[model samples]
Target: MSEIPPFEIIRASRRSISIQISKTYGLVVRAPFSVPEDIIHAFVDRKSDWIMKHLARHTEQRERKNNTLYYLGHIYPFEYNLLQKETVTHSGGMFTFSGKVKDSGMEQAALTRWYRKQAQIYLSERVYHFSWKHELKHRKIRITSAVTRWGSCNGHNDLNFPWRLLMAPKEIIDYVVVHELSHTVHKNHSKYFWNLVESIIPDWKAHRRYLKEEGWRYALPKF
Candidate 1:
């Protein structure tokens, strides 16, 4: 016998349904356009276990996100290759890679510096292109090695992107840049915000999925 569930339900004008049970925030339900309230409540009750598991996982993730980067001997990728390598550059900005180091502090510093520079170059150029195209005036874009967030937008419209984004493909990077810019118009991830995103980048769903699933592959290790 299931007692009448007491949970706040949110119905969106989209084609998906979800139930969120936050530890501190409590239970919240989201349903597709015009879903009946009774049906939504039934759905939440049907998947109570799953909702609890996800909420637990989300709590764990939030806790982990609060930690800081150690930046020890963790390996970081330069290009698409997963394996860490000894990277070097020629006269031009052209880069080359070999393999990882054993215990050379000098080599590690050199590689880290190179990665930071590369991140700056790649992120700035891409941010500039999208910012201009969307007419989303922003203060400045800089790449930092933040522990958690991929990117952020400040009150002044200053956009900050994680340097790790450079490790992914250009399309993924574009999605991040566009995501921050979209925030300038709508600060939250409301339906209108998503609509604004789809208007600019029609294939945004694929990119969003890629970032959520595979984007972590591009993240540098503790180093």
Candidate 2:
């Protein structure tokens, strides 16, 4: 018999027993009041292995989110700077910051402005490069501080991309640029739309998966 670690059990009106693993709470069991103590214990005992696995994962994720930063598809430890010419700069595989990078509203605003500036310059260049290579025409490139989406294409043929995307690797950034530009020709996600994306980026599927799975890293520290 496997030994289940310490856990908090909450009796509620829910229909089914559910297990949750949290960094703050460790293992938690939620069950309807109708479930007996023995039944709840047995259910949790059965899931002890899964509980341990997720606990470890949560610990790793928490440490990562606390101590590291992401840019260009790589994770780097943060180094504080008291004096520097730039508000933020990346060099030698690390990020050096001249001021408070977290827990401050001012720093968050600075980060947003810096990233949007970079996104405007980098995404625009990629858009122009691809547009010329494929003879795709578009009206303009716009950088946005969007939270819910990565990019959008409007009927005006203008493309909009989130500033947070600059945190991704160059290849992932290129994939998104190409994706929105593809909308210039096909507005919907038909086979023709994806086929065009695949034409430019043969491994487009991998990039899309990266964005879906790793998009959480593309955020500024909370103000």
Candidate 3:
């Protein structure tokens, strides 16, 4: 039998035991401080397969992030300059950051800020465009840092979209925008809601597939 991989345990004041694997920490098992060591070990044993799968995924994502220099649906080389003031510039298929980028964390932070700014401008514009084209009215639009979902619509008619969507192609971004705007009329994913989306974007299914299959490539490392 193969040896089980070792994992870190974090005992805290919590209700239940849970596991998390990320680039920063390979495998972390969190449990209530009162839980017995043997019970924790048993829980870990039961979840070992899931932990290994996520650990492998984390490793692969880290490797891919290391190889990627450009992001946001654009293939541009990222340039860094330590002598100049701390600012980011994009021009001529290049993104240049002039400032003290002390480490990978700082670099990721700078990129995240830039992505948010771009999302504010680009996503807002797209949302407005779609709303006007479809004669749809929405209370407001907000940018978010959600990891799992691309976009969401609340009962208040407020739409929230992840800044990461800027990393996808424009078509995919449009589909997400339309999907949320449709919620202003129909809150659920009923057949009428899908038909409404198809009316505006006939090929939304292809765009959705692209996001599902290729969106991970654009994921930035979590700081």
Candidate 4:
């Protein structure tokens, strides 16, 4: 029989077996404490193909993220200078930084700070431009660190957008801005809500498709 791939097994007070794979943790299996070791082994065997596929994906994603950084629909070469300094700079298609970035954690934190600042400036401007053009009255705008959503509109009329949106093209950014602003008028995604979005940006569907297919690649690394 083929050897089962090495994985960490955590027996916890849980109801079922679960598996996870990531760049940091290669493969992990969580099972009920009462499950037999043989059963756990069998489960892993059954999931080996899935585990291998995800492991390969994680590996490729890590390599790509490490190699490049995306900003404003442009791919920039990320450069780090060991010399201590205060901020990151972008010029000539490169993001250069000279700071106390001794590790990947520090680098990711500094990059996130820079991206958030840019998002605050750029996204706020787009939101205002669209709101004024469409007569949408939103209470406030906030930049968020949300991973799953590009933007959201709460009951208070406040709009929140993920800082990672700065990495997408301006059209995609406008689509998200218009989407949330439309929420100020229509709380749900009824036909009217979609119609409102289309009125503002007729090509919103194309932007949505691009974001759906490619946006995840531009998410800030989790270090």
TM-score of each: 0.54, 0.80, 0.70, 0.74
The 0-to-1 C-alpha lDDT of every candidate, in the order given, reads: 0.66, 0.81, 0.80, 0.84
Q: What is the lDDT for 223 in model 2?
A: 34
Predicted model with the maximum TM-score: 2
lDDT of model number 3: 0.80
- Give the alpha carbon lDDT tens digit for every residue of 1-223 in model 4: 4344688998899999999885577888899989998999888888877676667667757786655788988777877778767567888879877776457777777888999999999988998898888899998889989989999999999999988889888888889999999999999999999999999899988988998767767776544
Q: Count the backbone clashes (under 3 Å) in each candidate.
A: 2, 0, 0, 0
Tell me how candidate 1 scores on lDDT.
0.66
Q: What is the lDDT of residue 165 in candidate 2?
A: 88
Candidate 1 wrong stretches, greater than 4 Å: 1-87, 90-105, 221-223
When sorted by lDDT, best at the front, the candidate numbers are: 4, 2, 3, 1
Task: State the local distance difference test value for candidate 2.
Answer: 0.81
Candidate 1 residue pairs in clash (backbone atoms < 3 Å): 85-99, 86-99
lDDT per residue as tens, model 1, 135-178: 88788777777747778988888888876676667777777888
The regions of model 4 sitting more than 4 angstroms off are: 1-60
